[model samples]
Target: MGTDVDIALLVKELCHHDAETEWIEFKTNNSDAEMIGQRISALANSACRLGIPTAYMVWGVDDKTHDVIGSSFRYRLEKRGNEELENWLHHQLTDNASFEFAEDVVCEKHVTVLMVQAAFCHTVDFERVPYIRVGSYTKKLREYPVIESEVWSRITKSDFESIAAKGGLTLPDALSLLDFPKYFDLLGAPMPQSRDEVAHYLCDDEIILRQDDGRYAVTNLGAILLAKNLKDFPTVARKALRLVQYKGRGRSEILRSKDYEGGYAVEFESAVEMIMALTPSKEDIIGAVRVQTTAYPERAIREILANALIHQDLTVTGSGPVVEVFSDRVDFTNPGTSLVDLMRLVDNPPRSRNQKLASLMRRFRFCEELGTGWDRIISSCEALYLPAPKAVEYEGAGGSVRISLLAYVPYRSMSLRDRVMACYWHACICFTNGETMTNKSLRCRFGEGGPSSSTVSKLLATAVGDGLIKPVDPETAPRYMRYVPAWA
Candidate 1:
């Protein structure tokens, strides 16, 4: 059905759902501007607090009387200098909250629908304060213990750019640690000759904001995009890339660990190249000549790195990006959650928690078109004949988001390229010597359990035929025989 039918049906059909409360309500005559605004805030904040993805307020419907009376208000009408309604509301809001107004014609009656998407956070606070309504009344959201805590957590910004540094940092002190040259280069703007002019430029661009005192303070934007050391910026420093190489499988037996940090504009390309170096490499046979190849696909590496950089929560304190190399699949996870729906991540456009952060980072070429990052990653995986990447959003108990990507193994009937991957993973699994390669294990590893033992054997046999895998035992051996990664 259309939006009109869907909108009405939601109130009727979904009304019976367990979590469904009075998420949808109506009002007619009491349309004072500020009061209406407050009601909007109350409903929006309440919807988020109540855990509903969205809430609606319709005009021309008697809220208490439940009578349908068309509203005369013209929601589409705008005044001078108020062209962007959403932007205007966002500017007024202490936090970013998304809402839409639609005038639907139901039985020739016009209804103004004010719909709000629940904050990815706990509460939608206005001016940094969560306000709620109770029994036809409104009050401080903090009046309720549970709801209050959630609101504080949700509305609070964890991004260093949003968070003020301890005591206040001096401009030069912050600049001393970062590479200023990288900033100007990324902007393609001519650098002012004077050092003080550069500081003012950074500050004016919101890269740095000086304190009330004579000294200057670098914004999180400054620290991340231009920091000499991200570590100095406590909120986001840990977000620097971290790599852990294991001798066998899990990260328990780590051989090396390093944090990737530098100017977001200057450091990303180098960081990605360095991390790729730490991963496995292969020798490709091209026209009778064997050429070395990166064990993990470069696109896969870049895609994950960009995902890490762009989608991270930046709110969770001390959390950063981590890449754990396993004998089988490589795991890369960054702190933060996808702003878009989990299932829709690959297909949908990107949504960011910190839009400003996203905007500045985009200037540095750190991300592809918003919402297209996951698609690129998937395409990259398929191009290499690797299984489609397993992308996921992890919700920690404390309410943080972490995105993960698992490298795919190659097998025959999958891809000639995947066959190469299967060899590497199978051999790598065998190299562990503890877990055996079996049909179930292979299925579980690939997230597909439909294939039987015979099919798995053929697939493994194909890998062995290519000398990509050397099974540790006979074909009849149980799932205990471990295969080493072909590199070993």
Candidate 2:
């Protein structure tokens, strides 16, 4: 499945493995179509059961002596009745089974190889009966119920990120498909002088796996994080961030939209820059020149965007992270609900469905300190005297999480739910800082032009009535009352 160089290396490597291995079969010139189909099913199932990514069948090698004797097996010219050898075998196997055959000259002899992809979501079957390799012998899967069960269990626990997004790549193709420079730059390492050295690093990181055939397999994690163009990998292409700008606050009217086609690491900065450009800003006069300041802090937007990409549930097909820019607020929505309690997101340690993605992004400096993203978003908003951001989880069909960052809204115009949420988030921030929320502090949160002290006090009372916050000391005077999050 790789280049000629790959085939030569593979032939040499296969000679080293024990012929009794379940995932490998060696032959000198046997070209029986039916037997080959059965071997394909057996090898695929065995590979899956053994946690191997690929299975192999090599021709032109002595099974006992592992000698490089040329074979007359020309799979491309063979026929099964009126059907081509490859076509007939493909039709006999289950839809989940995949294989390819290659013929090349290696060790000065004619060599042939049949490469089979391991069964992933389901066991491979030929002729409507599953088969598996047992000590170099092919047998019916039903004869071994325990192995069948184990294969099913492995399928059930398979990780989407670990699956190959695309396979059968040469060294140059693999390097060109990913933003290799960005990857090394993120780690603050200089690019290696040799391409193979670069590949060594990628393989060590589990980004690109070196197949037994000397080819490369680009994993879903690598493609999602570093692919030069996501379109090259169909599985993760739909995972790219989609940004939509509305003429107003609702979705009915469309202004403009864009779907970033690069990997998360490659397009993160551009996505944030686009959002900031669409964000509402106000002009403020200083001593000399006027400065334009965005309503939402750039850091807050960047952090939330990164969170969305890192926390999204990759199992949810056909959906990805989305950014909706409205006149008054920006919403960052991903394809999964929060793993932690909604109320505890600010203080709880970070939990993500894609820990590998999160860890890599953190290493790239795209993420805030572990568990401090929400804290930073909250603190940034508070510094601008802006209404607190809200994190909501809509549950169902693997659920979803949406983080909404609001622009400045007057206290009087804020709905009761908005006011209560603001109070709760404010208390959460104060509690996280080892302090408690107070009337004067709440007033300052709303800025000097906010309503009177009594208005802030009434808002705090509403939050308490809603059980989102509680007085730190019940016996304290009303003027000196302080509050912490209800759970705190």
Candidate 3:
């Protein structure tokens, strides 16, 4: 169940939807328990087929006009053979299927919303019979043989990365199609002397599976991670990384572009090199010397690329990971949204859609441990006094995750809000380390040199005035004043 305001906004959004989608249904005061259970099953199954995360069954909205006339139905009060409606529904569903109903009043109308978790790795069934949503109608799974077959196929087709891109290849063909030498090198293992030995090694890693016909097939994992040319495998060629550099901030003027076309393990180093080459660098002046550094940290860029490769939704076709360089920033994008919350990305253990790919990447040292990549990225930027990288979700036909690394914008050119946010994040990082933000620390964070205590004090005053941070100890001496995040 969601908050009252959330439910109201959801209901309103559903009402404005053109028509009932397969993943959503509307009912007007209908309290038929049996019918509701069946609808739930149908919607849940349809959601899985449609690749949606959740399905919805809303009451109190007109199916035609989408008007909220209110619902008289109360699911909690409904009973079935001495059992509560929700309990009975839970018992009827297979695979431990679960759902919740949220009740709220919107525009003086009572509305009830049922949120159903999609059937994952299995089809949802009630009363031992699976149901499916066909357009606006709910029908028994047996009646729709094609959908039933498709649903079963979807449920059983687990581990998309492990699926074979092509089957029935001879040993020589398999070896030729993959960069076998690099694979062994990455693993620090001696390359097998014979073709058969290498084939067995690939089979052991599940990179290639022996076919029933006695030939071998390259799995999607093998092709994506070790293929000689990703383009050779038609199924995953679109997943290759694309790098584009624009003359300016927009896409209108293209400076240069390149599509990396090898397996991730093979192309990762070259890709990083190319990205670093295209990234502009700045000159740092020391007491009597000049030092050059890339605008963005190489480690951060590498981690972001590794993340794009490992965490992307390989199920999403046509779209691939892209790196776009603009005059002021570079955006690294990958197909699909992150499985973990964006706010928790830095500290939380990473959640990946392609665990095997991630595992192999980690094994190859392409990325850090499972959960530490974001922390490194954040720390790298913080150490360089660069603005924190911005992670955003681009939603459309299919969603994407993008992280942008901004060019080194001068502190004097930053907006008030930007300065405040930077200060807040600095305080957050310091607090996490069991310390407090002081003028000295803030100056060091901003990489300001030559004793600018007053400047940093003014920055802290601005943040405090904006209520983003507060003094850790009001009684502390002004010379040793420290601050912390407002929430802290």
Candidate 4:
């Protein structure tokens, strides 16, 4: 069993199963390094072939009786060659292939569990040979030509989003399972009066496909974007969005939380509304009237939320896109790391892991077309005089992409880094528009038009000193000088 209590329960549950599945295997106290490596490779490949996220190799359990017989295996401390066992395993496996070993005590018996992530986009190999699990036995993949071919096809040809959420359902059942009305509403099409017509519409969109058996298969795309209740489809319920609000700057103080369960299109509006309500706002007095403005720009928040939803990795189980609100900022974190470099987010074309989902969200007007969302967020923040939002990739186990929208901070209160970043982003935007950063433009960005030109020059010089921007013509007169980002 692993360090997590849930993993311990998972081990017990697997042991209770009548037999080992294609993605699950049992091992005794045998800790032969080569054998363990081969098993890990086999489980990983088998899991990919079976379209599962992870495969399990549980120790301390009997194969035949399915009994918890305790394992003395301590592979973590074992060594192969001059390297540790884990390091040796890593060197043998394909790129991005990973596995974890956990130790626990169950009912006074020591147990070790190995959790292997499925090979993705490539087949996993050990000692220059790919292995797979056939029933409960591990063997060289090429030994079974038929299975080898099938596994390779699965690896090279399959798209997770295109997989059917629920296969072999009747036309009526498929229609009943999804919210056709909302789909039509989002698409700006009138609802069909008949079930047959609705089924035809869904089929046309590839949401459901007609099978030879006269049944329909609901694709993951359809279920995730328009399912009546995402929970009805077990594989996608974890993809639902969760919103949490804290009482203060840290998470120690709890306020409120909600896990949105509706489809993305159905729940997006309400989720945004809830977030805006929880977000603090200020009262502004115009010349003759009063206005209420939120702590963060609504348009920027909407774009960030949509990006998180459409760009998340649907295959990651156990977690999904999360919106966490603290006193000073709102954080958007999704299950997968960004496809594009965080530093290039402002100028690079948007890259999404889920292209189909992105296309649909664009069609529904949930987000803009490719590459414009970040620009919009930046410009919106600039227009509001708010600090530019931050985008970063949190690197670790189950890595994620996070975007934070900081609360409104006056330009006088901004830090040196903040000023440099704002100037750099302003230059990026200007260069994108075929212009250059000037003292006047920089002053306008900070809403400090009354400041002397020399004062503005100091800010620009500070940016240049930090190597964030450079003068286009160093010898040009100060009054005629223009600047661009250092990389530009």
Highest TM-score: give the candidate number: 2
- Enumerate residue pairs that collide in model 4: none
Clash pairs of candidate 3?
none
C-alpha lDDT values of all predictions: 0.58, 0.86, 0.80, 0.81
Summing lDDT over every window of 10 consecutive residues in candidate 3, give the lowest-scoring window: 1-10
Worst 10 residues of 2 by lDDT: 1-10
Error of 2 at 296 (Å): 1.5
Model 1 off-target regions past 4 Å? Answer: 1-160, 166-170, 261-263, 288-290, 399-408, 412-488
Query: TM-score of the candidate numbered 3?
Result: 0.65
- Best model number under lDDT: 2
Ranking by lDDT: 2, 4, 3, 1
Ranking by TM-score: 2, 4, 3, 1
Q: For candidate 2, lDDT tens digit of each residue in 76-139?
A: 8999999999999979998667677888888899999887877866788999988999898899
RMSD to the native, candidate 4?
Answer: 9.8
Candidate 3 C-alpha lDDT tens digits along 49-97: 7655456898898888888989898988999989999988988888435
lDDT, candidate 1, 119-182, per-residue tens: 5444555656666756456676777787667555654533335323321234455466668888
lDDT head-to-head 1 vs 2, winner: 2
Query: Candidate 3: how large is its RMSD?
Result: 18.0
